[model samples]
Target chain A: MLSEFDLIAQYFTRPPRANGQVALGVGDDCALLTPTAGMQLAISSDMLVSGRHFFADVDPYTLGHKSLAVNLSDLAAMGARPLGFTLALALPEARAEWLAPFAKGLLALADLHHCELIGGDTTKGPLNICITIFGETAPGQALRRDAAKIGDDIWVSGTLGDARLALAGYRLNACKNDPDEPLGGQINLDASNHALAAARMHQPTPRVALGLALRGIAHAAIDISDGLIGDLGHILQRSGVGAKLSVDDLPLGAVLAQQPQTIQRHFALAGGDDYELCFTAAAAQREAVLTAAQNASTKVTRIGSIVADPGIAFVAADGTALDLQLSSFDHFRTT
Target chain B: MLSEFDLIAQYFTRPPRANGQVALGVGDDCALLTPTAGMQLAISSDMLVSGRHFFADVDPYTLGHKSLAVNLSDLAAMGARPLGFTLALALPEARAEWLAPFAKGLLALADLHHCELIGGDTTKGPLNICITIFGETAPGQALRRDAAKIGDDIWVSGTLGDARLALAGYRLNACKNDPDEPLGGQINLDASNHALAAARMHQPTPRVALGLALRGIAHAAIDISDGLIGDLGHILQRSGVGAKLSVDDLPLGAVLAQQPQTIQRHFALAGGDDYELCFTAAAAQREAVLTAAQNASTKVTRIGSIVADPGIAFVAADGTALDLQLSSFDHFRTT
Candidate 1:
């Protein structure tokens, strides 16, 4: 196995990291780049620490992919194009065999998105990975959640809650023999869409191109890493408006279609890690978006509509309404 | 405490990030910035975990400043202007008291350098901090270690070995009640120079201004974080050149000059955390650099010259060469 130095030279260091937008990269005391004309940089960051974000025994390759994926999802939500990213890695100890596949996964995503690895530092400690991703967009063209308003049609791409089901399955599988909530090795799915949702749960794809397409077309947008209802609340709150979502209108996949009603409705509204775009558009722009979705072969279901009221409300199948009191995962939460 | 949503709004969501270079910034799903015209972006990153880079009991304010200072030093070494930075902070638990002060120190340094806080993420874990700093310079203008040429004069800013001295005192301070090594709480300095050295150790300043001044003048540059001998070795290895140093020319601060010859030489030649600029310039620029140094009110001492032999040689007071085999601290070294 190569030492950390050899591993860095072989995999991490590239010949003067070249992305089309950079002035200088990789082989310098610092990489340098000039901003392109008529563009703004979009940025976001995420830190994934051992045990907090992933299991210690999880595949390093998967961890690498997921780490970048979550950050890319942020860029997609902002309607920006990936430029490049810097990774800061902390390891308890250097493990050459583990690093190779991990680097492969990280670079693979970088290649797919055309995001070059400009710079990074490696040190020691409990494994921690923090990645800061940069993206570009035309000035004032990036989508934000603050513009959703009354009379706007609310929409979401892909399905919601598949990721949650998959997560449950993963946890259940790990503790199959445990006395508590004893579901065996098989992932316990509530029949809404076991197969598809599980896959969605594990490797949620960021709707990058869709976000770009909706930059001007959509009134406002957010990436649903959190559940749809909660993520949409951001738009409503920022826009000083309200929303009414119908559980019946959701695009629950095959599993939910086959599930019991209670489970299907709950998962459809409250499940997280969709990594899909939840957006709004003026009633007038609806046709254009629908047409665009047809051409792009992606779904943009009008799950609800904006309201003059200033909060979120879920409409039942029979027209009953309930205010959700749940919150998504809070890593830094004190309670 | 407020939910994760409020925490982001209150602390994480910074000023509508208007990096003129970035097309977009925080609060959006992603961040965007255009590289400056004809310039490439220089990038670097580092992470400091609790119990790794510092003691847990150290002041958060100091920790924050040091966290940023270390990353900024990377940019300073490249002679790149400070642009912006992102911080990913992982905590075992949220403490408002800890966070507010930490942000204060981090923000103070960022403002001092005109570097904006572009983006970052937060999570719960064993306190870890990953900082990525982005800066830029015109294409081909960044200083690099590999460009040193034979006959180039080697220069370093400030003095060295003070940080180690400070560390020594800090350790002894922890063991005041013990008589181990026949030492106590009070330092056995030649005078109070050790106190000055200790401060230099604790808060070594990065030489950004001096470095920017040397742009287009210095042939190669690197920041002196590691000891001179070891760090200079990096320049030599990358440039495939050698260096001959006059030990008498080593910049021993007044604090160490009155000490025993061994301690003085060791501290002067082998001290780390100096955060000074160690650069090589063509002989023709010597006068210009000295002039610039005078204007900046900072010292620029030329200790050696790059040679064709491709290794480092130290000429002692007796005119005999000594090979210093000590390597400075490696963050990843296990032993």
Candidate 2:
């Protein structure tokens, strides 16, 4: 068996980047990072465990990508530019086949965002991946959940529910393949649609560029990790406001568009792991919002408007209030 | 079953600290932290998994303390002042009995250090705790592992090896009480002494004050988590220097003082989980080093001298060299 130090050196250690914010990288008691003057550090942590967060036989490369991508999504929600991150991994064994591609997928995203992997810890245990990411933004420029104002237009970037759609497919396929597997409600998806949705689930694109572009424009923002209704509720609760959402206006994922209207509404409204940004902006900034989306090459859809009342009212296309029973993904309750 | 949000609000959430460094805490996409002007941020992450880092049936309170304590020790090694920390926890279930005391112990330490609990993620899985701690220090003032110089006097703060002794006691006691348990080498330890050693293992002091006091005085330093010989070897390898260690001069813990000579030497030399400061300073600065230790109320012991050679030489009190076979704890190779 490879020693821990050797394993880290072989898989995780990288040459220090020139002109990087990190003064010292790995092989130290603590990594030293120089925050830019007049900037605030934005920090977030996310942990993914096998069989709970992902399937036991998930691809190591995609698992690594999703791990850091989810954390980077948090930074994107805050309109913070990626700086550095630390990974704490627990693995049952140090396998060369698994580690090689895992590091490759993780570092590829880190490199694209100019984010450095400064330091981390690896130990022997059941597989778990936890990343704490750091980013920097000017003071008062970060889009916070509490900053939403009544009458602001609520917009969402890209599509939602593809990841959740993929999850349903996986559950259904597992039940069909093995009768002993627990049944999750029935769902039908073609192989091509399943692959597209799975890609969205495994390789989420963090809207860092869009987040940076929306700085000073977005009144409030949050990444859609726990479904739209539940995540948007966070903004509503924190800002002491409500929302008038057009249920028919939600941008459906290409794969979900093929499903029935009921499935489309449910998946798009309450599906988790979307990793898309739901942001609020001034009603007059509609043109600017479109321009920003164009500049980042990401699609944007106006789905609703913030209201002074305290609860969300779902409206159908013909202006009738829709009564739906839906809940966001809760790790403890749902799992 | 409690939801993830309710669980966080019930046990982990605390009121914002007065005049704290954190601009935003929990309930946000990311926590915002303001770094002191002209200070560099120091970051470190540590992950503890059940059955690997701690006993499966370990007390939740002590486990909580140890989880954060080890991460804080890394900040102490860098001579950094505590700022804030992000926790990522995984639990099999939400049991109030376990979470209550666990959060109490964790937050108690954070309050003592004035380190706010900013933001984190809670999920359902096999129990694991990962904390990424941040601290601040003036540039060029951090005690780095690569600063050790030839001819510098090697010093250590606090006692060593008690944690390893306690571990041996636990192993021996388990074997004696349960025939099905794996047999570890037999060791006799009275209950009183065992308790003393166990406390050292559970609740370790981070030596932050001593690290601050020795900011410019010590040329290089590292916290000894993996035993003296191995950790000191890191400084030597980093600085391209070696050391001449006096085997008899090592400071033994109170409980280890009663052990046989061979046991004392082995435990002090290669036993892991010690969390003490092993540092090196100029030969002429011995008095200054002593004063710094005195001010911090921590004991300082000089046990060796840096050498121009490329490997450590063990010297006995009688001025003769002795060869010993020893290795530091490796997470993958060890249990």
Candidate 3:
């Protein structure tokens, strides 16, 4: 059995990066980070528990990727450049096979974004992964959720709901093997579509570049972690404004678009784990928004407009009001 | 049965302090913090598991206090002033009875230190608390473990072994109730002594002020979390220097002072959960060290001196060698 320090040294510790932001890294009582002059620090934390956030037998490699990816998504929402992150993990045991690939997947993403893993703690317990990530943004330049203007156009980056479709497929498969397992509805997908949805669910691409690109163009933003309707509701509630969302105009994931209209609408509107960016911008900046998306090489869709009213008014392509009851993912309220 | 958002709002969320360091607090995708000019941010993370770190039925208030206390102790070791923190908690269920006191204990300590709760994530799982604390210190001023030098006097703050004694008492009680329970040896403590030890174990006072005061005085410092022997080994390993420790000179907790010599030696040397600061400084700065301790209103005791060798040499009051086999706490190797 590996000691806690040995496990951390083998799987997590890395030499300090040349960036010099981290004055002292791992192996210290506390990691020291030199903040960029005149920049504000954007911080966010997310926790993932086995059997709640992810499957007990989910690939450890993907689990590692998703754990850090979800937190990076928050930094992306704030239009902040990645700085570093601290991971606090509770594992059942120190198995080399599980740790090697898990670290590989986690560091692969960290390396891609140049976000160094500065420090963390490891302990023996039920499986849990918590990451607190830091990023840097110019003061007052962060795209806040409460900054959405009344005349702003709502834009979503990439696609939504494929992760939810993947989850439904997993649940459906489990229900087939164990009849006692609750199946919300009869949901099925072909093998290829299942793979596509699963990939989105496991390996989310945080729109960091798009966020940086839209720093000046975007008025307000939030990463679509808890579906479009639910996440956008945060912006509306905080901004003290309402929105008119075109349900038919919602960008569907490639795999999600193949499903029936009812499934597409339900999953796209109410699905969790999308991890795409849902942001608002003035109508005049529509061209700027498109240019920013082009620069970031990410897709953008104008699916709605911020309104002066108090609650969201979902509408069809023909502008007919549609009533859709959707509640965001709540850890306690949900399974 | 509160929703996750409602639970956070009710117990965790607080209005931003007038200090104005937190540009944005809870209810956002990410919290924005404005760093002080020329100050480096000190970050540390700690995770406490239910069964391993604390008793399953322990008081929620103390658990809350200790959860943040342990993290703050890391900052204290780094000589960093409290700034802010992010909490990521996993609970088995959302029960108001548990959360109310837990948050109270946590916030009380946080308020004392002026560490604002900026942002966090809440989820449902086996109870766990992971707090990533932030503090600030001027560049190159942090008392790192690698800065210890030969001929430096090793000093420890407050008391040692009381927490360990308290733990032994609990384990002994458990062993009495269940004979199958492992008891290292027959041990007993009076009720009042147990309470003192228990307080030390549960609500440790992180020496933040002393750490700040010792900025240029202490050469290298580390908080004694994993017992003095294990924690001091880190300094020796990192600094490439050893020490001559006077085991008899270790300041014992008031309750621990009444224990037998063997028990005192064992717990004082290898007992974990002691949040006192163990630091090293040049012999010439003894008066300066005392002044710093006085300024912080914390007691300090010199019990050892750094040596040229690569490992610690335990000694008696008469300077005679004392051979004692002691191993530091390793999360995976211990219990």
Candidate 4:
């Protein structure tokens, strides 16, 4: 096995050749950068550990993409431009093949989104990955959750619930083995749906451009890590407002549409892992938002309205009000 | 018995309030800060994990402080002023008492040093902590490792090897229990003479003021996590220069001076965990560095000079080259 130093060198330190504002990169005491004048720096950090955040047998490449992508979603919520990020990873041992593909997946997104790989640390331990992203936005202009006001239109991008269905092997197409296991059903099912959902769940788009595109335009924003209802409740509580949504208008995917009613509603309301932008905008600017989103090649679907009442209430298709309570994701609630 | 939410609200959320730059802190989707215009952003990140960088039973308080302090030292090395930081902590289970004192220590240092805990994530996993610190400096004027040139004077702050000597438990004090074993010595001693070493080992101060004081004045700088010779070599490689050190000029703490000659040399050359600043400056600015050190209530000792050559060589009191090679902590190399 390659030692830690060799693994770090082979995977991390080649040269700086990415986008966003990367003034100084890796191989130094600390990363350095200059956020443009009139811009405020937006920063967020997250750590993913072995057997906790991912299965021990998971692919390193997917892990790398997920780690960085999650932090980028934080920037998206703040309506800040994606600038660069630092990664600190821990591992039990060094495996060259794993390191090579992992670094490729990591840098590939970095290049795709014009984000610079600034500074990071690699150490020996159980596989733990911590990434911090640095982004910028015009001063006093970044979208804030606390600024959400009553009577605003609540909207979300992309579809919900597919990532949840993927957990059932719907995205993976075929079950790998263990025929008797319930989650292992449909052993011969097509793999494309399962594969697509797996990709979305593991490495969903961060909505960076859509977020920056909403700057000054959207009053409040957040990325949905928890299920739609649960995550939206956060913005409502912090902003001292309430929201009412229609289940009929939810932007769910094809897999979910094909599912029975009960499962579809369950996924739509309680399933998580869709990293789409959920934001609120003024009623007057609704047309402008639709136009801007269209121009950016992203979808914007209005599902409800922020209200004066102080709780999240879901209005079912038949007009019955469902009693709902917010719950945290696994480990987030128990950690 | 407390769960993750209780752990965060009780420990991490309580902290020193930030000043002008930070508009909000903790308990948000993202922390918001507005840096003054005309200032460049300086950033650095680090990660520490239980059973890897630290033992699981190590004092959580000191671990918290040291995690932030090391990155702060990086800011100091660049002559950047402290702004705020994001913390990502992962734990297998939430322990309230452990987190409380840990947050206390971390906030105490942050308050004294004028930094703030902005935002981060708390997740379930083995104990892992990652902190990313942001700082501000004049545009295009941050200190860098590659700026040193031949004939520049090499200097270091505080003493050179107290941290390393303490690790060996030569004559220090009683030590704490190993974090992982509760019985096994994390660095192998009863915290004995090594107590001071271990304490210094655990919480080395970042030289923030010294860095800002040297801004636009010093040629190069770096924080010494990897020990003197090894870290200084980083400067040599980047600057395309060499250095000659006078062993006799190395500053040994009064305790370390009492040790045998061989032990003293070992501490001076190869010991690690001394978070002091090692930097290079023009020979003409030597006096200014001395004056600045006095104002900062620290000593800046000049032990040698950068040379036209491209590697490090030790010069003895007799003015002759030492035959033995000089190297300090290389993380991957087994001692």
> What would the TM-score be for candidate 1 when compared with the true structure?
0.89
Residues B196-284 of candidate 4 have per-residue lDDT tens digits of 55677677888888888887678999877777888788889888899998877888755567666655666666667777888999999
Query: Which has the better TM-score: candidate 1, or candidate 2?
Result: 2
Report RMSD (Å) for each prediction in the order shown: 4.1, 2.7, 2.4, 4.4
For model 2, the superposed segments whose C-alpha errors exceed 4 Å read A1-6, A176-186, A330-335, B1-6, B176-186, B330-335
The pairs that clash in candidate 2 are none
Error of model 4, residue B20, in angstroms: 0.5
Model 1, residue B212: C-alpha shift (Å): 1.5
RMSD of 4: 4.4
Per-residue error (Å), model 3, residue A318:
1.6
- Best-fitting candidate, measured by DockQ? 3
Give each candidate's interface RMSD in Å.
3.2, 1.9, 1.9, 2.4
Worst 10 residues of 4 chain B by lDDT: B178-187
Pick by DockQ: 3 or 4, better one: 3
Q: What is the C-alpha lDDT of each candidate?
A: 0.72, 0.87, 0.88, 0.75
Single out the weakest 10-residue window by summed lDDT for candidate 2 chain A. Answer: A178-187
Q: In what order do the candidates fall by lDDT, top score first?
A: 3, 2, 4, 1
User: Relative to the unseen true structure, what is the C-alpha lDDT of residue B147 in candidate 3, on a scale of 0 to 100?
Assistant: 94
Docking class of 3: medium
lDDT of 2 by residue, B1-335 (tens): 23753565469887898646799998899999999998999999998889877887888898878888888899999999989999898888888888988898888888888888898888888888999999999999999999999889999999987888888787677666543212233355899999999998888888888989999999999998888888898899999999999999999999988887777777888787888999999999999999999999999999999999998899999979989766666211142
